[model samples]
Target: MNPARAPQSVPARLAQIALYGVAAAAVAGLVALIVSAVLNGSLTRSGTADALGWGALILGFLSGAVAYSQSGQSRIESTMRARLGEGYRAPGLPWPQILAPLIGAGILSAIVFALN
Candidate 1:
Protein backbone atom coordinates (compact mmCIF):
# COMPACT_ATOMS: atom_id res chain seq x y z
CA MET A 1 0.00 0.00 0.00
CA ASN A 2 1.14 3.57 -0.63
CA PRO A 3 2.10 5.82 2.26
CA ALA A 4 -0.03 8.85 3.03
CA ARG A 5 1.87 11.69 1.44
CA ALA A 6 1.72 15.16 2.97
CA PRO A 7 -0.33 17.75 1.10
CA GLN A 8 1.70 19.49 -1.57
CA SER A 9 1.00 23.02 -0.36
CA VAL A 10 -1.30 25.08 1.83
CA PRO A 11 -3.38 26.25 -1.10
CA ALA A 12 -3.73 22.74 -2.39
CA ARG A 13 -4.86 21.56 1.04
CA LEU A 14 -7.42 24.36 1.25
CA ALA A 15 -8.68 23.61 -2.24
CA GLN A 16 -9.09 19.95 -1.44
CA ILE A 17 -10.97 20.84 1.71
CA ALA A 18 -13.12 23.33 -0.14
CA LEU A 19 -14.11 20.68 -2.64
CA TYR A 20 -15.12 18.28 0.10
CA GLY A 21 -17.02 21.07 1.80
CA VAL A 22 -18.96 21.86 -1.34
CA ALA A 23 -19.87 18.22 -1.73
CA ALA A 24 -20.99 18.07 1.89
CA ALA A 25 -23.10 21.18 1.42
CA ALA A 26 -24.72 19.72 -1.63
CA VAL A 27 -25.62 16.57 0.25
CA ALA A 28 -26.96 18.57 3.15
CA GLY A 29 -29.08 20.67 0.82
CA LEU A 30 -30.61 17.61 -0.74
CA VAL A 31 -31.34 16.21 2.69
CA ALA A 32 -32.92 19.44 3.77
CA LEU A 33 -35.16 19.48 0.73
CA ILE A 34 -36.38 15.98 1.35
CA VAL A 35 -36.95 16.66 5.02
CA SER A 36 -38.85 19.83 4.34
CA ALA A 37 -41.11 18.05 1.92
CA VAL A 38 -41.86 15.25 4.35
CA LEU A 39 -42.32 17.40 7.43
CA ASN A 40 -44.47 20.12 6.00
CA GLY A 41 -45.74 18.89 2.64
CA SER A 42 -44.07 21.98 1.24
CA LEU A 43 -41.10 24.24 1.87
CA THR A 44 -42.48 26.54 4.51
CA ARG A 45 -40.34 28.64 6.83
CA SER A 46 -40.73 26.29 9.76
CA GLY A 47 -40.06 23.30 7.57
CA THR A 48 -36.97 24.85 6.13
CA ALA A 49 -35.65 25.71 9.58
CA ASP A 50 -36.32 22.23 10.90
CA ALA A 51 -34.77 20.71 7.82
CA LEU A 52 -31.71 22.90 8.26
CA GLY A 53 -31.38 21.72 11.85
CA TRP A 54 -31.50 18.15 10.66
CA GLY A 55 -28.91 18.97 8.04
CA ALA A 56 -26.66 20.39 10.72
CA LEU A 57 -27.07 17.22 12.75
CA ILE A 58 -26.20 15.15 9.73
CA LEU A 59 -23.15 17.28 9.01
CA GLY A 60 -21.98 16.87 12.59
CA PHE A 61 -22.37 13.12 12.37
CA LEU A 62 -20.44 13.02 9.12
CA SER A 63 -17.70 15.22 10.55
CA GLY A 64 -17.32 12.94 13.55
CA ALA A 65 -17.07 9.92 11.27
CA VAL A 66 -14.36 11.59 9.20
CA ALA A 67 -12.44 12.53 12.33
CA TYR A 68 -12.58 8.96 13.62
CA SER A 69 -11.38 7.58 10.29
CA GLN A 70 -8.49 10.04 10.14
CA SER A 71 -7.53 9.28 13.73
CA GLY A 72 -7.46 5.56 12.97
CA GLN A 73 -5.31 6.14 9.90
CA SER A 74 -2.89 8.28 11.86
CA ARG A 75 -2.60 5.64 14.56
CA ILE A 76 -1.85 2.97 11.99
CA GLU A 77 0.71 5.13 10.23
CA SER A 78 2.44 6.02 13.46
CA THR A 79 2.60 2.39 14.49
CA MET A 80 4.01 1.27 11.14
CA ARG A 81 6.64 4.00 11.13
CA ALA A 82 7.71 3.13 14.69
CA ARG A 83 8.03 -0.55 13.80
CA LEU A 84 10.35 0.39 10.94
CA GLY A 85 12.72 2.21 13.37
CA GLU A 86 11.41 5.65 12.43
CA GLY A 87 10.73 7.89 15.42
CA TYR A 88 7.02 8.11 16.24
CA ARG A 89 5.63 11.10 18.03
CA ALA A 90 2.12 11.08 19.39
CA PRO A 91 -0.19 12.96 17.06
CA GLY A 92 -1.61 16.14 18.53
CA LEU A 93 -5.34 16.49 18.94
CA PRO A 94 -6.93 17.49 15.63
CA TRP A 95 -8.67 20.81 16.19
CA PRO A 96 -10.98 20.47 13.18
CA GLN A 97 -12.13 17.12 14.48
CA ILE A 98 -12.81 18.62 17.87
CA LEU A 99 -14.49 21.82 16.71
CA ALA A 100 -16.63 20.89 13.71
CA PRO A 101 -19.23 18.96 15.68
CA LEU A 102 -19.49 21.67 18.29
CA ILE A 103 -20.04 24.27 15.63
CA GLY A 104 -22.64 22.13 13.90
CA ALA A 105 -24.48 21.54 17.16
CA GLY A 106 -24.42 25.24 17.88
CA ILE A 107 -25.94 25.98 14.50
CA LEU A 108 -28.60 23.37 15.06
CA SER A 109 -29.46 24.79 18.45
CA ALA A 110 -29.68 28.29 17.11
CA ILE A 111 -31.99 27.20 14.33
CA VAL A 112 -34.20 25.30 16.72
CA PHE A 113 -34.45 28.32 18.96
CA ALA A 114 -35.24 30.62 16.10
CA LEU A 115 -37.95 28.31 14.84
CA ASN A 116 -39.61 28.14 18.25
Candidate 2:
Protein backbone atom coordinates (compact mmCIF):
# COMPACT_ATOMS: atom_id res chain seq x y z
CA MET A 1 0.00 0.00 0.00
CA ASN A 2 2.43 2.60 -1.16
CA PRO A 3 1.18 6.14 -0.43
CA ALA A 4 2.16 7.26 -3.88
CA ARG A 5 0.10 4.48 -5.48
CA ALA A 6 -3.00 5.44 -3.57
CA PRO A 7 -4.85 8.34 -5.14
CA GLN A 8 -5.76 11.39 -3.13
CA SER A 9 -8.78 11.30 -0.83
CA VAL A 10 -11.97 11.28 -2.85
CA PRO A 11 -13.77 14.30 -1.47
CA ALA A 12 -10.69 16.49 -1.43
CA ARG A 13 -9.69 15.47 -4.90
CA LEU A 14 -13.18 16.07 -6.23
CA ALA A 15 -13.33 19.50 -4.65
CA GLN A 16 -9.97 20.49 -6.06
CA ILE A 17 -10.77 19.25 -9.55
CA ALA A 18 -14.21 20.82 -9.48
CA LEU A 19 -12.75 24.13 -8.46
CA TYR A 20 -10.30 24.02 -11.32
CA GLY A 21 -13.10 23.33 -13.79
CA VAL A 22 -15.28 26.08 -12.42
CA ALA A 23 -12.47 28.61 -12.41
CA ALA A 24 -11.49 27.74 -15.94
CA ALA A 25 -15.09 28.01 -17.08
CA ALA A 26 -15.58 31.37 -15.43
CA VAL A 27 -12.38 32.85 -16.79
CA ALA A 28 -13.14 31.55 -20.25
CA GLY A 29 -16.68 32.86 -20.12
CA LEU A 30 -15.44 36.33 -19.21
CA VAL A 31 -12.90 36.38 -22.00
CA ALA A 32 -15.51 35.23 -24.48
CA LEU A 33 -17.89 37.95 -23.38
CA ILE A 34 -15.23 40.59 -23.87
CA VAL A 35 -14.28 39.29 -27.28
CA SER A 36 -17.86 39.07 -28.40
CA ALA A 37 -18.52 42.57 -27.25
CA VAL A 38 -15.49 43.88 -29.06
CA LEU A 39 -16.19 42.12 -32.33
CA ASN A 40 -19.91 42.69 -32.47
CA GLY A 41 -19.88 46.21 -30.97
CA SER A 42 -22.55 45.03 -28.56
CA LEU A 43 -23.72 42.04 -26.58
CA THR A 44 -25.99 39.41 -28.13
CA ARG A 45 -27.28 36.18 -26.64
CA SER A 46 -26.06 33.92 -29.39
CA GLY A 47 -22.74 35.67 -29.59
CA THR A 48 -22.21 35.38 -25.87
CA ALA A 49 -23.01 31.71 -25.87
CA ASP A 50 -20.73 31.04 -28.80
CA ALA A 51 -17.89 32.95 -27.23
CA LEU A 52 -18.23 31.21 -23.88
CA GLY A 53 -18.44 27.84 -25.52
CA TRP A 54 -15.35 28.45 -27.58
CA GLY A 55 -13.41 29.76 -24.62
CA ALA A 56 -14.32 26.86 -22.42
CA LEU A 57 -13.51 24.36 -25.12
CA ILE A 58 -10.12 25.88 -25.82
CA LEU A 59 -9.13 26.25 -22.17
CA GLY A 60 -10.41 22.80 -21.25
CA PHE A 61 -8.37 21.17 -23.97
CA LEU A 62 -5.33 23.15 -22.86
CA SER A 63 -5.84 22.05 -19.28
CA GLY A 64 -6.06 18.44 -20.35
CA ALA A 65 -2.87 18.79 -22.29
CA VAL A 66 -1.12 20.27 -19.30
CA ALA A 67 -2.33 17.44 -17.10
CA TYR A 68 -1.05 14.89 -19.58
CA SER A 69 2.31 16.61 -19.72
CA GLN A 70 2.49 16.59 -15.94
CA SER A 71 1.67 12.90 -15.84
CA GLY A 72 4.42 12.18 -18.33
CA GLN A 73 6.83 14.27 -16.34
CA SER A 74 6.01 12.37 -13.18
CA ARG A 75 6.65 9.07 -14.89
CA ILE A 76 9.95 10.28 -16.22
CA GLU A 77 11.01 11.54 -12.82
CA SER A 78 10.04 8.25 -11.23
CA THR A 79 12.06 6.33 -13.77
CA MET A 80 15.05 8.53 -13.24
CA ARG A 81 14.84 8.18 -9.49
CA ALA A 82 14.54 4.43 -9.70
CA ARG A 83 17.59 4.22 -11.92
CA LEU A 84 19.49 6.38 -9.52
CA GLY A 85 18.44 4.23 -6.56
CA GLU A 86 16.90 7.27 -4.89
CA GLY A 87 13.81 7.11 -2.68
CA TYR A 88 11.81 9.71 -4.53
CA ARG A 89 8.13 8.92 -4.95
CA ALA A 90 6.14 10.27 -7.85
CA PRO A 91 2.40 10.62 -7.63
CA GLY A 92 0.23 8.68 -10.03
CA LEU A 93 -1.87 10.46 -12.64
CA PRO A 94 -5.26 11.59 -11.40
CA TRP A 95 -7.38 10.63 -14.36
CA PRO A 96 -10.60 11.94 -12.90
CA GLN A 97 -9.05 15.33 -12.27
CA ILE A 98 -7.47 15.40 -15.68
CA LEU A 99 -10.80 14.71 -17.37
CA ALA A 100 -12.89 17.13 -15.31
CA PRO A 101 -12.31 20.22 -17.45
CA LEU A 102 -12.87 18.28 -20.65
CA ILE A 103 -16.16 17.03 -19.32
CA GLY A 104 -17.14 20.55 -18.34
CA ALA A 105 -16.26 21.79 -21.81
CA GLY A 106 -18.46 19.15 -23.44
CA ILE A 107 -21.40 19.98 -21.23
CA LEU A 108 -21.02 23.70 -21.82
CA SER A 109 -20.70 23.18 -25.56
CA ALA A 110 -23.84 21.07 -25.60
CA ILE A 111 -25.77 23.73 -23.74
CA VAL A 112 -24.53 26.43 -26.07
CA PHE A 113 -25.51 24.47 -29.17
CA ALA A 114 -28.85 23.67 -27.70
CA LEU A 115 -29.50 27.30 -26.95
CA ASN A 116 -28.44 28.38 -30.41
Task: Compose the digit string of candidate 2's lDDT tens values, residues 1-116.
Answer: 99778888889887877777776667777887898899999987888787878887786777679787988899889889999999877886667666666656765677687778
> Per-residue alpha-carbon lDDT of model 1 for 9-76, expressed as tens digits?
87766556555555565567577879679867788777777777788778878777877877898899
List ranges where model 1 is wrong by over 4 Å: 1-35, 38-41, 97-101
User: How many residue pairs of model 2 clash at the backbone?
Assistant: 0
Show where candidate 2 strays beyond 4 Å. 1-16, 86-89, 95-100
Reference-based TM-score, model 1: 0.56
Q: List all candidate RMSDs to the true structure.
A: 6.2, 5.6
Error of 1 at 67 (Å): 2.2
Candidate 2 clashing pairs, residues 3+ apart or interchain: none
Evaluate all candidate structures by whole-model CA lDDT and list the values in order: 0.69, 0.77
Look at candidate 2 and tell me the lDDT of residue 11.
93
